[model samples]
Target chain A: MPSPRYTRDIPARYRLDAARCSACGHVALPRRTICSGCRSQDMEPVRLTRRGTVVTSTVIHVPPDEFTTEAPYAMAIIETPEGARLMAQVVDCQAEEVVPGMELSLEFRRIRREGHGGILCYGHKGVPVRRHEA
Target chain B: MRDVAIVGAGMTRFGELWDASLRDLFVEAALAGLGSAGADRVDSIYVGNMAAGQFVGQEHLGPLMADHLGMHGVPAVRIESACASGGAALRMGFLDIASGQSDLVLVAGVEKMTDGADVTNVLATASDQETEVYHGITFPGLYAMIARLRMERGTTTEEDLHWIAVKNHRHGAMNPKAQFRREISVDDVARSTMVAEPLRMLHCSPVSDGAAAVLLAPLDQARRYTDRPVRIAGSGMATSTIALADRPDPADLDVVRLSAERAYAMAGMSPERVQLAEVHDCFTVAEVCCLEALHLANGSEASQAARTGYSALGGRVPVNTSGGLKSKGHPVGATGVAQVIELFDQLRGEAGERQVPDAHVGLAQNMGGSGASSVVHILERV
Candidate 1:
């Protein structure tokens, strides 16, 4: 998942845009052209729910060069209520604190910088839902 | 399809061979395999490589290696499936002989991983760039998530993972060609530096530079190359979505299961019948998952087999007797071909101390990128 020039999916990557299958109602993240669960080509655009729960999480100690400063950070696979899963870094929490079943809310954040003094790449990351509760 | 048999096997000592170029490694393994076969009737060549372009800034390895091996004018091609490139190439070579397209074929797997570059980034390119790897996750972090999920299920324990490293290192100690040819206890694994929490350095395969090669011939004429030949009874390969998140289940690898089923069906044998195996152990967690997917163990209980020493060498089913990709060193593309080399040595009774007694039928399962794709082959001594 190192930084690459994926300019096409900017909308989906930034806004958490997804494709909702017209036939089977299966939702795919990052806006799929066709439904993954169903063989249906008919799809509709939808904004994914920012709120989700951590399905799985890990503390990345030895990270990539782009994330050297963020070593020993928490990353997780957050599953939304609509049944779409996306990987996002867990901010506003300790690495060990982000465990399975923890409530989270997706927030737009700076993911990393690509190339030398390249463009500032921004995407969705998971923040503990407790901040919103307060 | 006609019967296909492997008449020769060879590979370079897997490690950080700083002096060896990608071409040097391939030629060493290819010539050793040809020497083992004792013939030069190879009509075609297939090279399995993952990322020659990224790792060593080289590409078009097919013609390059074929010409380097003195296999001039023969048809040459490259097969790639991330880490499973080596295994996938073997499957392609098997088909070449089975389809009667080539009388003899050379299949080789090679990778140059230690060029003083950031290999972690090069390997991560195999994962989903936009979705997963973009989240600042390395390869270890990906598998660590799998291990975390399995641990939450209470079916797999940290000790279960440690057992895999312990058993593989024990086997690796006897393998002179292995990268880590020294044994270590469970504590050694526990104390090793954590690359990703719950996945330590000892639990991960090392960055290596090496190559492996095998020669395939029709079963009817295999004896012309070597008195002993291993038959490629079955080969199966399957692919899933590239992103692990796209997969229906992170708890298990369905690609491995589906591919192994096709292989078992072709071979007409069950997992119990096989005397030994070399499942892809890219991570310690991967081996346990593969055991169940290969039907060597049942469900998540595969970790139980590891804990009980049932998967150890000379146990219920010896897995990774050549130390696997873990202790043996994973040069990525060369791994699949290297696995068959282990089976060749074991089945022919050439494996000295690590030989599984009376080993006959063996299975080698190679997977790519968090089990998105898998290639399974069943080989038997004939």
Candidate 2:
């Protein structure tokens, strides 16, 4: 991964910022040139709500090189209230227990280190909101 | 536009292949295709490789393969659409002939995945680096999410997923060149190690290294190469947002539906007209999902279709007779061309043990990066 390209995506990953199509109210996370809902190019930045629900979840036993140490972790496609879905790891819970419809709160966390000499990458992970209350 | 036909098809045995380098595997398959066609040379070549740079530290495969295959000066190019590289290359080759641009074109797909690199990280290059991959998800984890969603909907059962593996392995056992050429039981699949929840090791395709090749020519001139040529009746391709989240539904696989619709329309045929199919079953769930999208199955309840033997060898529509990617060994870039080879064998009455009876029309659907890209080709006996 090139440093400049990696650096450019920092804000989107770190803060869950998205591009909302002005014409159609379609929110595209991490930004987009075309709106998926209406195919409009006019867009503006919008910060996503931290709250969401896991529509589906999986326990990753085999992971990428940087995430090898975190094998067997739970990952999910959590959809926010704004209708934007994103892939994130579900933290602080058993992998099997993470299920559809589970509430989540996105939090910033370390994702990985590129390679031996690469920079450390960080992104948002879904922490089950219900788990804390229980 | 002129009609195009595949005059010859060939592939290497699907496996780890410790002895063959990337270039060697490609040349071997290309030579076999040329030999099968009984032609001394081709006018041009297209090489399909997902990541030669990442997998083998070699890029510019088009010239490398063209040079290795002794076709030094002709137009050669590389095409990539992640896992769909092979199919996408074939699509371009089809267009090359259909548009009267080039008559003799050889398309080859190859991937050398066992090069001691981190397989998971290398495969992750296909995913959305800014959103999905950035959050630390592998292909298995991604597909597993698709499977988990289906399981929750009551449309698919765990048993349905297991049967796909069992069925493909049985088909693979009869194939001499398959990677895992042995049948496995439902219990075996159930007891296998879990890579992701609801998806065991058996449910997944192996990290394989192999190559497959196909030769294309104008349909009118196909007789010059072989008496039994497989006609490229139709071709369709579509792309979705790279981020899986951008799609309407993660479970729908809309791009697959769109591509299949286009191919079927271009062929002027319906799903019922297809006697056999070679689907991109990189995972068990993908087979069922794609079946629904292709309209081979009446509904999204593909679990019912699998359980009732709708996709069996002797059923309404035989699928994955080549053992699919699960058993056939998906070399990433080689899968599309390999699929066309299976269609060629079946249509020519050459597929011995796992042949679909009286097969005339066949469809091959190859997809890339979790439905980010999909290519569909419909073939028939010419």
Candidate 3:
């Protein structure tokens, strides 16, 4: 089989970082090389808030190759404290526990392991930041 | 530029076509399209395919498809833009006609996904291999992340996403060309096995084997082929960064927006003016995000509208009337042109029970690889 392509750096060790347009107030996540809205190259590297909230999510039973072992994992589109919106896996929760507006925090975890003898990959995953964690 | 119109459209039943070969599927669709157009000869051929080399260990699909269709020695070109390959091929064929380069052209897309290969790995090839896939993100995982972010932004809801799958599947049940031709309820979608978090088995399109083709020619020439011709009023295509994380907002698909903007501008219409649409619903969340990007509904209002049947066949501005990629079956390369075929049938009033009454104007939005590429086309009755 052909090697898999890791297209996005977000959620991975790269954990999408970006800067917003100060003039237009458009948030730029994953560190835009050039703002598509304002074309502003004058950007800053801003770390995204570790904490976020689940705005929407899905449970994928049928997964692609490297992710086969992790079927039925909760994936969500989360918004961070800095108003940064990204897609990440929701960890430390059952599939049914994922819901809209659920607060979460970012963490580095194993995303997928390659072929039988291949390498195991790591990335940023989102876990619910709840009051019961005490 | 001359006005290009779709004179003929053809599509095979989409599903696990184990008995069919890639070339066989392409030829079947191409021959049907040619027969419908009553054309004895094709001036040129264009094929849209995502990863034939990876999926079937076959490359050079352009000439291969041409030869298989018996249009040997013609100018055969292959178009690739991940999942948008079919739409991209249609654009190329459209240009050929509008430019007066060809009077009769064959635009086709096909993929043998269930060819007994490790399709999962093949599909991963559409992503940014070095960054996203290497980091262990599958397409579903990528979209799941997007759904999560959309939730945080209050852009959409899980129920909204589920409605997309359920509605498309409902429409798909009426489509003989669809792969999974069974109706599914929102509960069925919600209860399906999970592939990635928040995305259930029923929320995603199946890996299918199928083919679709459209015959394009000058509007004046189209009349000689068919009395009820569907005119290609406008087409728009755009690209984004390969990496999902490279995008500014994981929840938003600006490429689809840009393409829709250009297409709508060229067609002199707005989202409300479109009576029907066939969008790439590879995943349920994709449908929600795409609806927002196309301006079919406000991002925040998408979930509610979905629940209310605003995007259903009998509702205002019907969406995925042919079940979309979700139920229609996604053969990757064949996905785009299949959308066009659905639009053609709807515009011609040939869409039987699933048809939207008086669907005069329609649109098709096809995406490639997690929204990295998108192609939008607006068509109307001539």
Best by lDDT: 1
Q: Point out the higher-scoring one by DockQ: 1 or 2.
A: 1
Tens-place lDDT per residue, model 1, A1-134, is 23345677788788888988989988888887878787899989988988899999889989999999988899998899888889889998788999999999899999988778777888988998775554
C-alpha RMSD values across all candidates: 1.6, 1.6, 4.4
Q: Which residue pairs in candidate 2 collide?
A: none
Q: For candidate 3, what is the TM-score?
A: 0.83
| Order of quality (TM-score) | 1, 2, 3
Candidate numbers, best DockQ first, in rank order: 1, 2, 3
TM-score for all predictions?
0.98, 0.97, 0.83
> Per-residue lDDT tens digits of candidate 3, residues B1-382?
9999999988788999888899999989988998998887889999999988888889999889877777789999889998999999999999999999999999999999887788766777788675445444578777877777776677677788888888888899999998888988889888887677667778788889999999999999888999999999889999987767657666789999999999999888888889989998898888888888899988566666567888887787788988888888999999999999999998999999988888899999999998899999999987
Docking quality of model 3: it rates as: acceptable
- Model 1 chain B: weakest 10-residue lDDT segment is B299-308
Better TM-score candidate (1, 3): 1
Model 2 chain B worst lDDT run, 10 consecutive residues: B298-307
Report the lDDT of model 2 for residue B14: 91
Best by TM-score: 1
**Candidate 1: where are CA atoms >4 Å away?**
A1-6, A131-134
Best candidate per DockQ, number?
1
**Per-residue lDDT tens digits of candidate 1, residues B230-267?**
99989999988887777767868999999999999999
What's the count of clashing pairs in each model shown? 2, 0, 45
Q: What's the TM-score, to 2 decimals, of chain B in model 2?
A: 0.99
What's the residue-level lDDT of B43 in candidate 3? Answer: 92
